[model samples]
Target: MSEAFCLELYKDKVVVSYYAEKFHGRKTANGERFNMYDMTCAHKTLPFNTIIRVTNYANGKSVDVRVNDRGPFVAGREVDLSKGAAVKLDMIKTGTAKVKIHIVKMGANTKQSAVSAAKAQKIPITPSKGTAAKSQSAKKLVLKSGQLYDIQLGSFSDENNAREYAKKISRAKFKNVALQKSGGNTRVSVIKVDGKDVPSVVKQLEAKGFGNAFVKERKK
Candidate 1:
């Protein structure tokens, strides 16, 4: 599925952002330590080790980056580049750019292969009964009112880190900065609004240095 998706995205223009220096040395989704100097990138669904050529539309500069992690997570964005790749494309100052992507090599880590490997080891693919019950309990908290959109700043595993980040955002004069715990992670969101205002809220958050800010829909 991802192989076909990659093929279809070839030569298509995509919005991309670069990782901040604070993320250097952190463990990536593939269990590799992220080095900002490496020629690597992240895509939400691309197989690990997939190599893709990204060309900046404005400057015509190109860099071949290996897919080593997952996310940009925000809507309207496709790839997240390392510092080296961003420097190569001359996008450090601008922070984000429109680029064209061409898959140079397809990776071996496909969904089907993973499922087959799990089946060979007799690993369970479905959730456990307890997990399903927990999910049901969580769903009971959902509001029955109309949907609301939240401009999320970030998510963290530590409650202290989440609170500190939320405070920082609040100090910046961004109103309604709040934290919510879900799925063992704490999420800091700026404000909730109607669906029609999501784009403007996202733009404001991005201008305030929250480039990865995305929308989260919830019943209100």
Candidate 2:
């Protein structure tokens, strides 16, 4: 894979819809002996030694896993967790849970590159000085007496493309469209519309060929 595929942060958290039970004793893609009891995961592209923290958004249970192998190459499937990891996250109870993956650290060589990339991006550790204005606008928090929801556009490497997509959607009569950047390479476009229209926007986006478009509450 190209270096662009090298991810510093979890691109997105996908709820686990399934797990591998039969592949218990097989060797992992990294040639490490696999044990279903170990808190390890299989990711298609993450460097073999990257460490990712998986938090179950449902219950807030979390476990750190070593990315020691690869598989689950199926489309739309993000990462495959070992039985132990799933158990720790209490995901087996629901058979699935929304997970947030954060790469706190990576392998030795990849670590240097990751650090350099982070320094170059200089991602905001704290809210930036200008964010006060945007925060105020968002928190001005008007209720349309209808609905409020958030839509995430696919992550992208090009900021301009992300901005353009946000602008295009903003012009589509949307009430709000915002862009958030993380680690320089990942830009996400979010669109919020009245709550009553959440399903309509989801259907429209799906019909318009946007993948992974889901409705989330616009406010906490």
Residues 68-169 of candidate 2 have per-residue lDDT tens digits of: 765443435567888888889887767667776666577553544544432322111122332211121123222233555565654444455466556655
Each prediction's TM-score versus the true structure: 0.49, 0.46
Over 4 Å off, model 2: 1-9, 17-20, 112-220
lDDT of 2 at 30: 62
In candidate 2, position 149 carries an lDDT of 54
- Candidate 2 at 182: error in angstroms? 32
Clashing pairs in 2: 147-194, 147-195, 147-196, 148-195
lDDT per residue, candidate 1, 1-220, as tens digits? 5343444245457789999689899877676889999999986445678888888999988888998876665556778999999999999999999998877676785533322222221111122222111111123122112446566666655566567667766776778889988887677887666555455555566555454444455655
Error of 1 at 86 (Å): 0.3
Candidate 2 lDDT score relative to the true structure: 0.56
- Residue pairs with clashing backbones, model 1: none
The 0-to-1 C-alpha lDDT of every candidate, in the order given, reads 0.66, 0.56
